[model samples]
Target: MPVTDCYTCDREAEFDQLPPRERIGHDSLWRVSHATGSELLGWLVLVPRRHVMEVADLTDEEAAALGRWQVRLARVFAQELGTPKTYIIELGEAPGFHLHFHVVPRPVDLDPELRGPKIFGYLGRPEPAESPARDALATRLGAALDRLNE
Candidate 1:
């Protein structure tokens, strides 16, 4: 996607204006946010601050910090939300979607039927904006991220 039409870039523009649920945390290279239009909590997304569509396009500094952010989010999810593990994926396939990684919290009791890639079902079918549960989780996750990063 062109920079002008990129969804992730638009969201970055709305940085301070975004709702609490939309802005979780960020470092210099990557921004963490709750996935929009999803019914899940702790369904965090990690996107580069700059507009680059593929992993190969990442600068050396961006590549270096990428894995650390992934692991930190996973650890925060486990500590705060009882997530047993996290599912990290980067398809970079959707048009205008920008390059981002999904760091999904797989709870200990997740149904056997939704294991592995099947868990992607939790995405897309999202609750409305200002969803109380998702927003609340965002608050908790935000705080947890602070502690974890500290």
Candidate 2:
């Protein structure tokens, strides 16, 4: 079931209509999409197909699938972006926001100040990542994920 007001639920409801950048890939339990309003390329968000307000709300199956998706997305980052590390974060503090995990790529040459949790500073920047670039990476990353399943 989905919460009527949740962003994740709204997107999930339109999964079939979502663009490549919005619907990178998904399975029975989870969905993956490139983060919007962020300047950082390859910033991905992992969300449950259903509305989940808290991590504890996840069923055992959902939890397992979440771990698998996290690892797979990180692997995709390593292979596609040459990310030295990836930060996985979940903060369901905003109203109408469903639980989601942020899989942010840590660039090899990232500024020391932006390392670790500070990397979040890249989000909601003055200028968002260009759509063409995001879409291109989405296509490539989506293909990489497909290959990994082979």
Candidate 3:
């Protein structure tokens, strides 16, 4: 379906303007990175450059490229974060009517009770202390993406 006036479209310029530390990677049509203030490991988000509400609305090229990017990111997360599995998620209740995917890395040691719902469970909760460990992980993942592009 055709799109108009969606927040993602309106804010396309702002995506590039996001600081370097927040950026994980970007192809022609999508931008990917870790979500700000996430409490878990390797919590990534992939957002389309254009505004679209649903995955089915993606153009054929976008559909193909999106899968490729997501898979590549999953590999990077696993390799860099020591995650055993990666969960690709799409929860669309937000101001940005743009299609996006979440690449959540699942570490083997995660508490079973906190594994699923609690991964992103603290989304709106008060921010946690600055974790040097998470910062290091992000640096490694960002460096990994840079190497992949080489």
**Candidate 3 lDDT:** 0.72
| Ordering by lDDT | 2, 1, 3
**Span of ten consecutive residues with least summed lDDT in model 2:** 1-10
User: What lDDT, from 0 to 1, does candidate 2 have?
Assistant: 0.87
- Report every candidate's CA lDDT: 0.83, 0.87, 0.72
Kindly report which residue stretches of model 2 are placed more than 4 angstroms away from their true locations once superposed: none
Q: Candidate 3: worst 10 consecutive residues by lDDT?
A: 122-131
- For residues 1-150, could you state the per-residue lDDT of candidate 1 as single tens digits? 437977889888878897666778888899988887666667778999889888999999999899889888888887888888899989878765678998899989888988899888777784654567767878888888898857
lDDT (tens digit, per residue) of candidate 2 on 38-100: 878888899888888889989999999999999999898999889879899997788657889
Which pairs clash inside model 3? Answer: none
Give me the candidate number with maximum TM-score. 2
| Residue runs of model 1 more than 4 Å from their true location after superposition | 126-130
Query: What does candidate 1 score on TM?
Result: 0.90
> Residue 150, candidate 3: how far off, in angstroms?
4.1
State the lDDT of candidate 3 residue by residue for 1-47, as single tens digits.
54567644655566657654355677788877666566664677888
Ranked by TM-score, the better of candidates 1 and 2 is 2
Q: Say which candidate scores most in lDDT.
A: 2
